[model samples]
Target: MSDTAAAEAPSPSVRSLLIMAVPAILVGVGSALVLWLLDLMSEGLQHILWTTLPQSFGATEATPWWIFTVLTVTGAAVGLVIWSVPGHAGPDSATTELVEAPLRPGVLPGLLLATVIGLAGGVSLGPENPIIAVNSALAVALLARFVKAIPLPLAMMLASSATIGALFGTPIAAALLFTGAVAAAKGGGALWDKLFLPVAAAGAGAVTMHLLGGKALSFQVTPIDQTDGWMLLWGLLVAAASALIGILLAWALPYVHRGFHALRNPLLISLAGGVVLGLLGMWGGPMTLFKGLDETTELLRHPGDYSAGQLALFAGVKVLALLVAAAAGFRGGRIFPAVFIGVALGVLAHVLFPGIPLSLAIACGCLGIVLAATRDGWIAIFLGAALVGDPVVLPMLCIIVLPVWLMVTKAPELVVHAQPESAAAKA
Candidate 1:
């Protein structure tokens, strides 16, 4: 039906609400399950794909460049397919969009296709984006196909809540992320009142992931001495620095994605950027290619593996890589990559200030930058704690978020979200 036709026949708020929600819960569970299957198959897929590819291709962990080449080619091919599909080409995801747009069906397919291409194809991205959209889309589909008597408001509630739940694996975080967006979108009153449904949906999503036997998301931080009052102080400093970097990145996104209109064709621009990135990867090794989340895991597991100089270089390189990725027309995110950059900066800061805990410094930079970039404190709080594997950082992150939030919340623009998708596609 046409949008006008649909609008004239709008489902009653109460009735539509119910229609949208049932599927949300179902979608959440389904999304978590799909994500689990993908994760489980990832290593095996990587191994098989790597074994078959030629060596003189690109960079990867342990595997040769040829593996990355195969992956890259496949991703582009997938992108071509998504470009040809009807409806929204899925979403650009993780948890953010769950809160951004609730009923975008087209976005879901586009995102799912993109993420599968990103992961299975070898271009660096994550399941979170596709997970959020697919799960939500599934919820809407279920409601429409089965539950015919609900209000759109309730359905919208269910759709959003289920997505939030599926993405965060915590109803509380899912609800918070969802409600926070609502609150931000419309400034005021009883935000908590709107949170319960989404939280419940989050629970469904989390339970589903568990049933699928996926590892719960958690971070690892070496035990830190609480006596280190100076750590928090240094955290404040790191937070400030990270805030600046995040803002700079956010600001740079529009221009970088556009390549100042110097580069017009997205695929060509992306491929060109990819080639440059590939060259850089050739020198920087596997750590230089792909999204840097795996590198963050490596850093936590073996902080000693990096010296101050190496960390500094890594930090600079990641920032550059993210800029290039944005400019290249690839569909991925900026946060987890920021995680690597933040840690690199934090490690360097720790080396400069021995009294400050390296872990604490990382917490500040990562969390602070995310806050500045997204202008959402609670989400950043959850992400940072999860990344660092430290709960203590939560309270501290909350505290640090205050000043940084004040500095950047005025406009409350998302670096990537601020730009149009075509800009992103081209960037």
Candidate 2:
């Protein structure tokens, strides 16, 4: 065709989406499998560490000293892996952007190992980042061999969407999380059109999770009695306070990270991190350890079980643990820890003011911390409402985000921004 004729042709007909549908679905399913596998491996290892091994040792419950020893040893193992393993166990988790270039094929195994070790060893982070990176890398490598027409960027999106969907047990979370980024990109198309494949992949991923009996990230909070204008104001205060707390951590995270970096030895820094984390775990109890998924449920299952002081201690120590874990070079994401902190904070709110509904307080607490950590208002609101599994909480979270956004807008992000040379080195 002539140049004008080709230029005038619309880019991929709107109805031609079927061409990419199969690939998207396949990528989503593949991503979900990887996520499931990671969960299984981590949980199996944790079972041994927390249960079988302790039973073998004749302990009924893991003592604080046991917890301390386990964490310290886990840290040393991770440090050794990073020190001797190829790919340096992938990039430093503290400095890597959430979504970046797909990792080299050779680097994926080390990354996977480090992630599993972190999860099983009670590292205070979620599987979000590593799973996404792993899936992205695998998707790109797999697609290039079989489906060369699919672009790398689109492969990245499909993989990311799939992993996110599987992680949360829904495509809605994935869609909502990426909506902002998609809308902001330069393109000549409807937003939904751009989101079609991602949504397809996400739907498949969510379905895969259901098929595999993957745990959904949800809570069974009591339904709100009746939302009111007063509730909105109350939510605003709660969310703002929580966001401020998160922001304070965000500000301090970099300095602490650098302080650890000053040691200039991955083994020592990570070991020290593990030791500090062990002490924190000893002080805070088991609730503050690991990624916050199961612990969040534990908190909700017995909301009144913890006293005001214990609740406060849980929140503070979890935040500090999260900071130390990330700063000290563990491979994980902030969302789970943030969710745990939010839960503790919400419980604290209830303790301080008994009148507030438990569900609402939890939602607001999640809202503030999520908003601050992600620096994304929409995600924060989604997480808040999703955590409680209540649609009624959405409007209140929406209203509360307005204030939370203002507080976090100027605050430093939870990630440490590396210098150009360091960034290149990481890549």
Candidate 3:
């Protein structure tokens, strides 16, 4: 322990980095498995509801009455579970953000059940929040038990990176999402030092997701070979309009949530919410139900299959569906549904302005809505480019997002918050 020897020895940062590398990879693999299981559970249930039941009754997938009945029952079931179950099925989503403190280990089961049922029963929600919560909670508990040297915050960050990576089928997207936060940390060292473990975890998660044959968010987008100045202008207009629409929905979310909560009973409130969602599903047809991932693919595969008016209706109904699903007692995330609405809007815009490139139009549409809803510009742009699977769209989307971000920078996010336990219980 000579002074010279000590000075040359590995620093705490280096030591922490070494300790976390392998463990972070393991966490990523574990998180990806959890996501895969959730996808299977929900998709299986969807098959039953959309295919099996319809076949049994000699009707098409998700008949209007069937959609109504399933959603109503789903709301009741979720409400009952949240009302009487232990841990209250984790926290109310309205009270939480895309990232939050991990829940107690005991709470994960109820949360899992609620989320699976919501996804399965065609609720307009995504698995992002619940899956991340579950993984973060588990990672924290494990780290505390076996690797106390790893900080809880670090463990949580790795878990989030893993889940996000698996969700989008890439570590780059996860890295982009966390870039701002990582850079904001109070440290003078290289930024890569902080991002190393998160990126490792994200890479592992992405590889595992690919191994499991998980689908990435992609559409058959036409590649953009040339950038037009007028196209950029059109993008700004489309993006701005979409952002404004998202802001309106954001403003309405709290009031709508309050109206549902005023029922005072989780059962009645959830049931009423379910009925409303059911009617919306019926009116909007099957496209409006479930998280928008699969439906978005279906919508984009054959753009000519739908008309401008139909796309607009679909977009409007989906926005309402997303709000209701989040404000109601459902345990899920809004990002996927929001993406769907954005895509629908983009499709509608393209239909109106035939001169506009479909890829640019859709990317701008997503940029506007996602920027407004999530208020995360990096994620907004990532989503827009990811959907198109085009590198050229990146710069175009980046430019389009500038105006959209300005429009939404001062606006409120689409989340609801109220008095603690009472709101949590009712919501």
Candidate 4:
């Protein structure tokens, strides 16, 4: 390497890096605040819907009728908002990916409103997708107006990284997810150089979320102390089975979406979807109704309380609920509900075959299903390991994920591609 050649290379100087870091950190903090505010609003509304209102009606607890009513009405409310509100609650969630191009500022308010209602109403979806979209849109618009020095693409990256960090309670998830993406892109300088700003944003977002007392994604599970040949085999089987299940769900998504859209009226479709979800909820019970984070912890808290059949039912019902909610135009993400299904399936595996270690089963199940659903290996592996909070399960998950990845590599994704005319019609 000649001195002149090295000097001419595109290296980020400390001053430039520092200049970028300020905005990155600020974006991270802002992203976390947005997530926190949404969560707070949702929780408050949830209490009113499930507790105060129910109690006022002289229902000491959430009965089947109440569940049916709340979900059914929630569907109508969300539908009304989408139908009447400006921006129609942004793009159809079925058509968007976790990360995508920025949306117009006008679309965000309706999107956020729909998301809040879905979250509070016990819809079987997570805040990841809508929240990410909201944050990304806001960050891009704001940065473009105030900080023109940073490009739009980089702004999007910072917002996404920050949100992922806040959601998972760690910056590493964002880093791992972006590593492959950055590496694949045509760029100059070292890989770390490209990653520097995103990582800084993710770290700040993670720290801000922690400071805000966000709950951790991991749960307490029996740690895997050792590995054996049999465990590896069982891990492979569990992951493969879960992956197949996810693939099936992905294959069905578009058809289900079509069925819902056939109603040709957003309100009616949502209402019908809500009725179905209510039935599923009544059967699956409260644990299967909302995004699966807290429910996951509750399930793992006493795995012994459920038999294999019950575990299977939970997983099955939750899967149906997720499909219905997403297909019906309810606005939210699928990742959290998918995690619940995976956890339930994993626990079911253990209940049926006690020989396999619990941690491995859970990790592999989560890894497979998430991989199949998102088609993102990095996020899948991260969620799998994060769920178990066990490093020993990593090597096994790394190997198990390979075959599972192959299984879903060519599978249909859980998204819809509405025709241009149809999309405009909805708009």
TM-score for each predicted model, relative to the true structure:
0.78, 0.95, 0.95, 0.96
lDDT tens per residue, model 4, 1-427: 6655654578687788889999999999999999999999999999999999999887733588889988999899988888878888887788888888899999999999999999999999999999999999999999999999999989999999999999999999999989988887664567788889999999999999999998778776899777788888999999999999999998999999989988877788789888998888889888888899998998778888998888999999998999899899999998999999999989999989998889888888888889988999989999989998888898888888888888999999988875453543365
> lDDT at 331 for candidate 1?
55
Clashes (N, CA, C under 3 Å) per candidate: 36, 0, 0, 0
In candidate 2, where is summed lDDT lowest over 10 consecutive residues?
418-427
Evaluation by TM-score, superior candidate among 1 and 3: 3
Runs in model 2 deviating more than 4 A are 1-11, 419-427
For candidate 4, which ten residues in a row score worst on lDDT?
A: 418-427
- lDDT top scorer: 4
Error of 2 at 108 (Å): 0.9
lDDT agreement with native, every candidate: 0.59, 0.86, 0.86, 0.89
Judged by whole-model lDDT over C-alpha atoms, candidate 3 comes out at 0.86
lDDT for residue 363 in candidate 1, whole number 0-100: 78
Q: Tell me the TM-score of model 1.
A: 0.78
